[model samples]
Target: MIHAHLTEFHGLPVRYVDQEAGLTASQVAWRVQGDSYEEDEGTFADTFEQLLEWDDCDEVRALVVGTWGWAHNDDRADVPVRLLVEAAPRLPALEAIFLGDYVSEESEISWIGQADVTPLLTAYPRLKRLDVRGGDGLGLRPVVHTALETLRFESGGLPAAVVRAIGASSLPALRHLELWLGDEQYQGDSGPDDWAAILAGGGLPALTHLGLQDSVRQDDVAAAVATAPIVARLESLDLSMGVLTDAGAEALLSGQPLTHLKRLNLRHHYLSEEMAANVADGLRGVEVDLSDRQDPEDDWRYIEVSE
Candidate 1:
């Protein structure tokens, strides 16, 4: 009955559905609703519980949980972890979950607070994909899960400790990973060295798609990623929605063989028109995206998603 609130995307395209909507999967947001902006009709947990009470709750495949009417004031706000842990048994077929899908109009990504989510990984062993937004109090402890295939952390200011935890994780089945390293002004503190450690590690043996997007230090990240051994094994790489300059593209040009990858996404960058053309020329066969060029006049760089 509540299967309409779920969707599964393999990458840019949707691939799976739980309900027979007779509609293309691309059009569905699969989001659960909350109350009015001024009224506290229900929290994320309240809506989740309502779904869990349904007879076909186990049919839900991919769920996007977001706040309806309230903005989280702190870490311990909206959608308690315990409720999910308790409902795991009922959602046996659940595979993908995107926690905190609030937009700027609803609540800015930076203001969308979160808490430790390590238990959810353990609670839902069948889960294959997980995307989380916000990083205020978000924590993913070093875990050894086998079935998880995709893991993403989207934040305005991703913490250094969380990066270390991901580096220490034992996800042997992971295939796609993305980390949005936002500006330091919003609390993003992880440096290039931290990312270097993650790239050097052998824990992610099955990773094929990698994304280190939306960073103030895009040039540094690009420099590090160009030389990282992980690049050789990836089929697609995403460095979009950040402040990448010509220098960063130069590092990519000289360091790695971009011709082998299926796709390279470098949209929402600050690269010069000449360098953009060069990138397009260099990777002729590869599907390259160089749109949304931003000009930094006052030495100011903007991350794609922030308050």
Candidate 2:
């Protein structure tokens, strides 16, 4: 679902330089096969090992993983996950990681196979940020982590289990959490009621920004979030990249006093012009995003990402 490739991660530039090109303190590079289907001379493991043995390996603090191999055969990132977990000791400076950073052209978000990243968290107890893009074969267990600050799952169809797993997990220092709940056809089966734990602010004490976006039943999500206990503490709320209508907007506008929020992002929606105007007019002090308005197809609303 991601169109653009990453230029930076964890406040460092992302590059594709070779070992011969040398590494700098301000940037991190990834070695990817030119073509997803091409048989690379060296596998991803080779590149990872090379990094571990690099003279400047200690300087590497963040990593951005791109194309792994021939994804047409459903190439999974399981090996990479294992490699990263095993290499945790060597990557002590590592604080952030973007697993599955490929764009749609390299691999469709839904088609990109991922694995249980729970072990990585346990291995890297100091890891503060993790951004994973893809849901196919993805896994997560509700494990408590004290240092994690941000966690994101970018998927076309985020499995319902993973959604609930995040809600059930205990993250005390988590400041921002973004979950893209793609279409059910791609595996995301979560509904409004599923967001209870997260919405209720069960275990997330430092959560200031929460995004439960790109859902099939966004109206219900909005309705649930309207009265959810989490909103009171969040400085920003993102309900974008889904099929939101006036009904959902009405619930948010009428329910809670959201004037305390600094930003309310509802981009890529199906809100009526009147409702859009109402949202802007209602949240005068709050920064409201009402861009990328879409027209329903034969009365059928479509989400931004549901592959």
Candidate 3:
């Protein structure tokens, strides 16, 4: 007998992909448009409730929902957001939730509320990964304490309160953290100091790997990295594709107490030879990445000390 796997995109409908016995897994992609689906907005709540009654649905392995746009418009009768929230109770098997361009647009703020998030998060106690990009200004305080192993906050600004909540909540299972700042409408300026304060207060204690991309300020990045005592526990750190400078590198090396960091990336930065040497000297055992520099092939040589 051939086994089939079912996956849903934007909670529209489930698409089944045929799977062979023990070989590689097959990949399938499905896209839904408003014209193709006949269900109006008012019927969404019921439709979603019925869909959630699937016997095979023990947990949601992955959920990708629209945050804003036509799906979230107040005038639209068939809002997928409402159905997604309502369907949350049925997605006990959900392990990962991906919020796509739904949250990225500027017009869908009215439909995206804190209440909508509560049901889904409350329902998926086993949720491991949360990837949210854009939407109404949803505060992070409510969901930061979830049992997530990998947390990616992209293109949105995180407020201080939300930052504090993540620190206070001991996320023991968390291993990977990715912060992509400055992509959407943010409430506060995510300066390095703000991030520093967040780490000093203990945001991600169990993080073993971290990635930061598209940060605006270098000093803030430096300050924030310097403040993270948890870096000492990290095995890999990626700071590629950002506005990080030599000062940031120096701050991370000299200020931050990263004793266990084995791999460090400093790609696409403004690091001088001296700063590179300083970093090489500070992180003696760690492998440093200096790719994407003006002088890519240049070797980093640390200063010699004679007694």
**Residues 17-130, model 3: lDDT tens digits:** 122123211111221112223434324234344435545444335544432234344333225545655566665656766554333233332333322344444556777876
Q: Model 3: runs farther than 4 Å from truth?
A: 1-55, 66-82, 101-119, 142-146, 156-162, 183-188, 201-203, 257-259, 277-284, 294-307
In model 2, how many backbone clashes occur?
A: 1
Off by over 4 Å in 1: 1-40, 75-78, 296-298
Off by over 4 Å in 2: 17-22, 25-36, 296-298
lDDT of 3 at 182: 40
The local lDDT score (0 to 100) that residue 47 gets in candidate 2 is 69
| Residue-level error in angstroms, candidate 2, position 76 | 0.8
List model 2 lDDT by residue over 1-307, tens digit each. Answer: 3898888788777766364375563366443323446565667777677777777676677888777875547788888888898888787888888898878777778888898989988998888999999999999999899999999999888888887888899999999999998888899888876788889888899999999999878888899999999999999999999989889999999999999999999999988888899999999999999999987443887788876
lDDT values, one for every candidate: 0.76, 0.84, 0.51
TM-score of every candidate = 0.86, 0.94, 0.65
- Sorted by lDDT, highest first, which candidate order results? 2, 1, 3
Candidate with best TM-score: 2
Model 2 residue 190 CA deviation in Å: 0.6
Of 2 and 3, the candidate ranking higher by lDDT: 2
- What lDDT score goes with residue 168 in model 1? 86
Q: Which residue pairs clash in candidate 1?
A: none
